[model samples]
Target: MRGVTRSAQGRGELTPMESRILRAAVRLFAEKGFDATTVQEIVDAAEVTKGALYHYFDAKDDLLFEIYHSLISSQMADLDRIIALRLSAADTVRAILVNLVETTASRVDEAAVFTREMHKLNADRMAAFRADRRRYHETFREVIDRAQTAGELGTVVPADTAVLIALGVVNQLPTWYRPDGPKSPQQLGTEIADFVLAALSA
Candidate 1:
């Protein structure tokens, strides 16, 4: 099993050393493929010693796991809390999309690295990642499924299909979403939500 950081972006979740190592890793990982980025390079980039890097992460792969885990864990926490509010389906979906966009946009480097290197995670880490992803997918599916079952939304497609379509676009944003672009993540999320709700409402 790889080392796991509780929350990469959460204030106080990581020590200053942990944060520095993580930032350096994201930069290096984004610039060079994970296979090409060495631990010594990470230490030099972060200006930390080998001991500091090893203290926080078990190995380079552990660093990779941490980079991807932290982002999803953060998103899942937001999703869980928003869903607990028991908002109407449209509102819940809006909260989720907006949060997802904002979070993903803020962590583009992590997302990009994960997209390219995630298949390398160990079996245990892979299982954990899969569980986190499934929870997120199922939660969103339930929202749509419940709405359709209650006759609140049009049944244009299965809940799984709708979820995949919605997540697919956001997941691909790493290739082209520019933080300096005209729209802020919030605005983009709202626009996306509007489009998705339009489909459900029709």
Candidate 2:
């Protein structure tokens, strides 16, 4: 399989063909189980030839892995960049929530693709993917840990628990979040951050 190539950093842009194929893969995989979604379906949905699909991916599993990686990797890169900026831990936590919720909501199809199909990767591939996911979580945990050490957060709360709460709030937003809802993503993020901050300070 061709190694995944990026057109730019922090931009979730894909080659035109890659985009089409990915869109088809996500849609089909979401509606049909990975095992049930065939290369012909993807090629037809993508409006590409069988040879075109083969040029980009070796097989259905390869396409799935690339699609999942592309979705999560872009998110991780965006969050990592934001976290690296020296914003206050409180602000950083809020930023993390907003970013996560907004991304999850905006990329609903991709998130659905991930939640529905990630288990289809072979064990070795899944393990590597899982590690990347853990690193992203660890990124948030480290920031929360720093905040706790600096007395910005409650000393009583375990860092891992604090991180989990923050992430849990953000991660679950896609389940119920509506773009036209009363609360903006930013507002919801602030609310969640406020709850975390208050609880941690107590």
Q: Pick the candidate with the highest lDDT.
A: 1
Q: Tens-digit lDDT track for model 2 on 104-178?
A: 777766766776677878775577567667877898888888888898777667889877877776666657777
lDDT of 2 at 1: 35
The lDDT for every candidate, in the order shown, is: 0.85, 0.76
lDDT of 1 by residue, 91-202 (tens): 9989999999999999887898888998988887687678778878998999899999998888888889989988988999899999899999999999999988988998
Candidate 1 has its poorest 10 consecutive residues by lDDT at 4-13
TM-score of 2: 0.86
For each of the candidates, give the backbone clash count.
0, 0
Tell me the deviation in Å of residue 27 in model 2.
1.2
Off by over 4 Å in 2: 1-13
Clashing pairs in 2: none
TM-score to true structure, per model: 0.91, 0.86
Top-scoring candidate (TM-score): 1
